[model samples]
Target: MKKIIIIIITLVLFGSCKKDEPAPIVVPIITSINPIQGNPDTEIAINGSGFSTVVSENIVKFNGVVAKVSSATSSTLIAKVPISSGSGLVEVSTSKGSANGPSFTYIPDIFVGGIESNGSKFVGKYWKNGVAVNVTNGTNNVTIYSIAVSGNDVYLAGYETVGSVKVAKYWKNGIENILSDQSKDAFCYSIAIDGTDVYVAGSEFNGNQYVAKYWKNGISVSLTNGQVSAEAHGIAISDGNVYVTGQEALPAGPLVAKYWKNGIATSLTDGKYDASAWSIVVSGNDIYISGYEDNGVNYARYWKNGLTNALSYNGNNIVDQIDQIVVSGSDVYVAGRQSKTALYWKNGIAVPLTNGSNLSFAHSIFLYGSDIFVAGNEFNGTAKVGKYWKNGSAVNLTNGFFDCSPWGIIVR
Candidate 1:
């Protein structure tokens, strides 16, 4: 009788402890979530109290989108942001109850494209905020010079080596679309997109000389004759009008910087100085173009409505190689190399992206909301490090192992 009574008492004590385990973890009290804003699939830690230690016991939702809780503890839970999740409050559900946390903002995805070398031949690829996706085969030489995002599709313009010639092509969502045949060598420099229409600006060799042209939905339209060598470096579409910027070589051997508005060319610089327009932007009724003019040496200058103005830094006109030009709310932004250091100029004030620690160059500038993004690369004396800047904050995209050159960027 005594042995039976002792065993019964032990069983009652163990059952009581099992019921107490779930009672202590009441409704979760969320203290905070680190990094209030992040892109989709980004891993974020939720710091709080009353969370169950078992991962299956805690459920996290970002704006009603369920997130996978990889791990959990009494005070914290690591959850991944669900794909396609919008901005809203974060909620955590447990067996005890549900708790509402701080609002989680979603950062729109950033897209950038360039070339990365793997010891031997260079191949083309792009990055969505550091996650790389290969667009070209590694056996041949391929390069992506420009990239644009439209809705859910991504378009890239560049060239690929086939036999003895370089063929101009564009990739729509990583699928290749050839723009030029193998009759002559060709090169693609820029790409732009407007609802259902894909435009690519490039140069093609037509027996005698390179012709400035652009392709609309894979159909070619020549902007210049085959008389002189000319190449379209940048393209933009505004208010149903197509604007192409390039340099037309004169008979006297001087290159004249010009832009063609619906096939009608307007010269921005005389043929006396060797100049080329690298980028063009149209805002409202204002037209802006950025490039360099070589008088004695190369000097960065931008033309606003056919009037030339130098890029200013510290109240003085700065000199360097400018690559991309952008206009946001009456402010002009330019990205390039200043004294071998990568920098971007906002309304003529030079904002250096690097501390001159290593050789760097800023090639593309993009504006998102109130944030400024610049894409470029830096040479650290050992390897080329792919980098991009957001509002003057540096973000390394590569691990400095292979060479990376990012020439274009777009954030949406």
Candidate 2:
């Protein structure tokens, strides 16, 4: 009996000495990613808790593309963006568990910029895949005429009217940068970003006439001599050369469609009719410009390398207007209005976007791979409706409760 009591005590003591099992590790939770978007080989840090301490045990993927991790800890991990990674949710996996972080938008996402009226005033806005980013309040009238995205920065060109003064400005990631003060009214009609340089083309009031001008990094360079009313409506950069297209108002004559290369003007039309150039694009050794001319008929046309081609339509007593132009590979595209309907042209063939029951207009065009996108507006019986068309399908950006219009679109 004494021996059995001693054995029971030994067993009890052994049981008491046994170690308690470790608590199960919490699942890995991802709180954020620094500099969420970048090209291949871009190092990004993932910040969160419950990460594996062993560097070799953590796995990171960007849209299914495996990322090479450099270091790991309980709350952080550093990884490089995998080559050929597209935009999608970023996931981090560990032995404990896996977690999803915020979506990292790949560079070259589709962006649209424009304005919307809210019964009282006009507010400027831009969108990244239908998510609205309001750039202004309705206190003053503002417009966003163009959009350009480079790296992780977004630039918008337009003007804001404060009382009687029109202010030319551009927005970089929603922060306004003023280009014109109250000295004279100004309008920024187009913007082009090359590396870190910002170029804007427009017109600023010069005493008795509006002078066509282009600004490089906010430094003004006049394209016309301010002797006549002129406007620079479109800008393009290629092969270390700057090209701007618009019209020069001839004294007591019609507006002439012309383009300037490095401040030298090239006439595209005879001074016999009112012609305007709205957009320009340079591809290889060719230059393409789109606009309209009133030669007894309002004809929508595009000029290619100083040649001309008219976009055809079959409507009686109707007018056509071309607002934007784009060129891809061997194809040329233009967005504008046909009669009272919004439409686009591919290689000079008209593709309608709306029925002719109300007034509509197409202002911008963007091509992605094999897909075509056009931003415009349609009058929905009661109000103006903003629209973005993919291929032939239309996506309305706003309900028909107020006036809204999209003027610029870019699909990187």
Per-candidate RMSD, Å: 9.3, 8.4
Clashes of each: 0, 0
**Cα lDDT for residue 289, model 1?**
94
Mind giving the per-residue lDDT tens digits that candidate 1 earns over 1-412? 9999999999999999998785444788888998899987688899999899999999899999899999999999999888667789999999889999999999879888998898787788899978998888788788888999875687889999887899999998889999998879999999999999999999999999999999999999999988999999999999999999999999888999999999999999988888999899999999999988887644788889998877744453446678999998789998988766899877767898888788898999998878899999999888889889999888888888888999899986
Q: Candidate 2 local accuracy as lDDT? A: 0.87
Clashing pairs for model 2 are none
Q: Candidate 1, 298: how far from true, in Å?
A: 6.4
lDDT of 1: 0.89
lDDT of 2 by residue, 22-130 (tens): 7777888999998888766678999999988898899999988788999998899999886547788889998778899988766545688999988988888888878
Q: What is each predicted model's overall lDDT from 0 to 1? A: 0.89, 0.87
Using Cα atoms with residue i matched to residue i, what is each candidate's TM-score against the true structure? 0.76, 0.78
| Residue-level lDDT for 314 in candidate 1 | 45
Q: Runs in model 1 with CA error above 4 Å?
A: 1-104, 312-318
